[model samples]
Target: MVRQTLTKHPWWKIGVIYQIYPRSFQDSDADGVGDLAGIEARLDYLANFGIDAIWLSPIYPSPMADFGYDVADYCDIDPMFGDLDAFDRLLDGVHSRGLKLLLDFVPNHSSDQHPWFIESRSSRESPKRDWYIWRDPLPGGGPPNNWISDFGGSSWQWDAATGQYYLHAFLKEQPDLNWRNPDLREAMMAVLRFWFDRGVDGFRIDVLWHIVKDVAFRNNPINPMWTPNVTERDRLIQRYSTDQPEAHEITAEFRALADSYGDRVLVGEICLPNDRLACWYGTEDHPQVHLPFNFQLMETAWDAVTLRKTISDYEASLPSFGWPNWVIGSHDAPRIAAKIGEAQARIAAMLLLTLRGTPTLYQGDEIGIGEVQIPPNRVRDPQDLRQPDLGIGRDRSRTPIPWNSSAQAGFSTVEPWLPLNEDWRERNVAAQDQDDNSILSLYRSLLALRRSHNALSIGDLTLVDAADDVLAYRRQRANEILLIALNLSDEPRPLLLPENTCIAKVLCSTKPIRPISSTLDPNEGLVLELKEKS
Candidate 1:
C-alpha cells in the first residue's frame, strides 16, 4: 500500500539533518577553536551538501567543565565561540542559504558557576535555593540516595555552605536544575523564547528524558546484568532517577511553545528502549517532540539479521503520530567507520539514507573518517578521565574535520583543540572531492538520489526476505518502488528478489562500479528500481 505523504509536512519531516560539533567544524579566527563566524564561513559548503538543517552542538557560555554542556548562561553566546553578533550573522547566513539552524538546548543542568546555581548554593535561605535539586544528607551525612552520576561515583555533591547535597547527573561542576520548581520552568521557557525571538529555528533538547526526576528521591534498583565491561553508572537500573512520567508534561509544554512560532521543530535527545522511547511522542491529541532522536543504529549489532530486526522493531514501536529519526554516530559515540570497517561503513551509509525516516548525518562521516587515537595528556572528555578503564572518552570522535590536505587539516590556523585524524593529509575533503570513487562522492550520490526520489525520502518500508547476511527492504510510494539490498558480511551474496519482482535499473551502489548482476560484492549495497511481472 502507498503511504500518503502529509499535505502540509514541515521541512523537518522531509528534510535531512546534519549535526556539527562546533569545536571541530571550522575556525575562522587564528584561535585553536571553532566559532560562530567559522560556521558562517562554511555555509556554502553545507548548503551545497543538500542538508535541510544544521544541528550545532552547544555553544553557550560555559566553563568548559563538560565542554559547553554545563551551560553558564543559556541566553547568551560563549565568548570563546563568538559574541551575540557573530551568532546573529551565522543564523542569517544559514537561513539565507535555505537551511534551518538548530541549537543544542541544555535545560537539565547548568554550570555550578552560573549565577543561579551560585545563589542556590550560597545558603539554605537563599532566594534561588529551590532553583536546583538540593536535599539534606542522610542521617549519617552521606548522599540522599544511591543514584550514580553519568560520569561516575555519586550523583550528589556536598555543598558545605548550604549543608545539603545537590544533584548532578553529570560532573560535580554541573548541577541538575529543579524542573519541579515553577519558577525554574518559567525561566527555562523564557530561554527558549529568547532564541525564538532572535530568529532561531528550533532546538535539539539535551537529555529530554532526565528533565523531571523522581520526587521521593528513592534509591535505584541494583542492575542484575551489570558487568565489568560497562561503566560504573550501569551498576544500577536508574529506574527512579530518570525517565519519570512527569517528563511528558514538560515536553508537551515545549511543544506548545514551539507551535506558537509556526514551523519550528523540537528534536529531543532521549536514550531509552524503543517502547519507552515512543512515549516521548505523547498522544495524537497532544504531540510532544517533532522527532525523538533514535540511536538504535549506533547501539545495535552490525549484522544483517540484528539490524533487520532492530529496524522492524523500532518501526513497530512508534506511535501513530510519532515520526522516526535515525543516527549512526554522534560526538558522544564512535564514528561509523571506526566501529565497522571502511567497507562496511559505506554499506551503513546506504542503509541510513534509504530508511523510511529522517536521518541525521554527523560531520566528517561523509569522508569515512575513523576515530582518532587520543593521548592521555590531550584527553578533554571528563567521562574518559573519570573512567579510564571503560575507554569511554569521546575525544576520538570529536576531532577536527579535515577540509584540505594542509597543516591542522585546514580546520584551524593554530593547533586544534583535539587532534585531527592521522590520515588527514590523504583523506581530506579536497582530495576526496577530486576522486570519483571516494566516500564523499558516494554520499553526494546517495543524497542526490534521496532528494530526487519520493520513495526514498517519504515511502512505506517493507522487509524483503533474504539470507542472514543480506538485509533487503522495499520502499514504495504509489507507482514508485525502490529495493535496497545490503550485504553485511565479508562474502558476496546473491540478491533474493521477492515473488514476481524484477529489477528495472540500478540507481546507486557503494562500490566504485554499479553491480551488473544479482550477486552483490562483499560489504556492498545497492539501490535498484523494481517492477512487477505482467
Candidate 2:
C-alpha cells in the first residue's frame, strides 16, 4: 500500500483549494441571495469534505455589474453579503476549521460607481483623472483604437463632457485601471495590505495579464484564424491589449508585498499558452506568483492522447522553482458534468486530485451538478445579453448549489438569484451523502486517499504507457509508487501495466467496487500501488 509521510511544502503547494461562489453557496436570510452567515453555517460540511483551503469569489462592495468583479470598495464588504462583523466571524470560523481563506482580488478594473472612477470621470484636470485610461477621440470622430471589449463592441467609451474616450476591456461600467500610474499602483497595493492585515491567507488575482496594456494604444492586429463561431473579441490577436511585458513587473510587486506577510500565497488568473503562462512564475530569485492557475485541462479535448500531451507539455514548460496548479471547473466555465458526461467527470476528478500539483475544485461539482439552463426572461449575465450569438453567458455555471431536495434546493428560503438544476433533488449533497455509489462519495474517497498518500501530493509524475483509450501515469516519492490509470472512452479498456510491475493493491477508484484484474470499466479510474514482480 502507498505510505504517507511528512513534507515541508507550503499548504498552497500541497493543499486542495475549494472555490466558493459566495452568491450561490447558501442563503441565511430570505433575500434570495447568499450571505456570509450562510457560508459560516456550512463550515462543518466543508471541513468534513476534506479541503485545505477555501477561495471565495469577490464579496466586496459592488454595483453587481459583472457580479462582484467590479469592485467599488476594496476594503469593505457589500451590505448584501454582510457587514465587516459578519466577515470577521466567517474568517474565524474558517480558521477554526483549519482551512485557509483566499479572496478574489480584481485589480484590473473597478465599477464605474467607484469613487475613484467617479472622480476620474468628473473632469480632465481631476487629481484621479489618470487613475483610469482616458484618451482624446480620434480626429475622424471615432474611438482612439480598434480594441474591442471582452463583453462586446468597442473597448473605448466616449465621454461627451470631456471630449475623450476611456478604455474598458469589459463592460462600459467596468473601467480598466491604469496600472502604469505610480500612485494608482501604490493605492491598489494598499488594498492587498488591508486584506493581509485581516488575516486572509492569500488572493486569487483576477486577469493578472490584463493589468497593463501597450503604451501606444495601438490597434491589435486582425486574427488570421478568426472564425464566425468564435467571440468577436477574438477577431483580433489582442497582442497590444493584453499579456503585456510590463504586467510581470506588477505581478512581481504583488509577490513582494505578499511575501512580506509570511506564509501568504499569490495565485494569478493568467489565461495564456503554457510557455507564456510559465513566464508569470518569474525566476527563482524574483518569483511573481505562487501559482499562475493552469487552465489547459478546462479547454483541452477530453481524450487520453490529447490530455496526456497537455499534462506533459505543461510539466515541461514550468520553471524548476514554479509549482504547478490545475483547474477543471470554475464559476466562469461550464460545469464539468455538462462539458463531459457524468461518468467522465468522475474520472476527471480522479485526474485532478491525483495530479502532481495543487487542485482547485468548484462548488457543487463534487455532487455532479451540471449546467442549468436560464430562461430568456431570467437571464442575468451581461456577456450573454451583449454577445447572444457567442453564447458565453456564465449564468448556467454560476447557478445556486443544491444542498438538499427542499424548496430552492436548500440554497435559499426564497428563489435563488439563479436557477438550480432540474435533477437537484437526486443529485444534491444530501441525496449523494447517503449513497455509497454516488459521485460525491467518489470525490470524498479520492480526497481521503490523497490525504493519506504522499505519492499523490508533492511527488514526481511520470507518464506510463497504456492502451489508446486509457491515460496512465505513475506518481512516485522515494520508495512509494502509485499508478493512476483513467479510461477516457465509454467502453471497457485493458490496463497495460509497465514492464516488471504488478498491481499490489487498489488504493482507491472512481467506481464503488474496485477492479482486481487488468481491465478498466467504462470511464473508470484507479489508483493502484505498484510492486516489482518477485
Whose lDDT is greatest here?
A: 2
lDDT for predicted candidate 2 compared with the true structure: 0.92
Indicate the TM-score of model 1.
0.98
* Model 1 Cα lDDT, one tens digit per residue, 92-174: 99999889999999989999999999999988888899999999999987999999999989999998877889999999999
In candidate 2, the residue pairs with backbone N, CA or C atoms under 3 Å apart (3 or more residues apart, or in different chains) clash, namely: none
Q: How high is the lDDT of residue 39 in model 1? A: 88
Write one digit per residue (lDDT tens) for candidate 2, span 73-183. 999999989999999999999999889999999999999999999999999999999999999988878999999998879999999988899999999999999999999
lDDT for every model? 0.91, 0.92
User: What ranges in model 2 sit over 4 Å off?
Assistant: 1-7
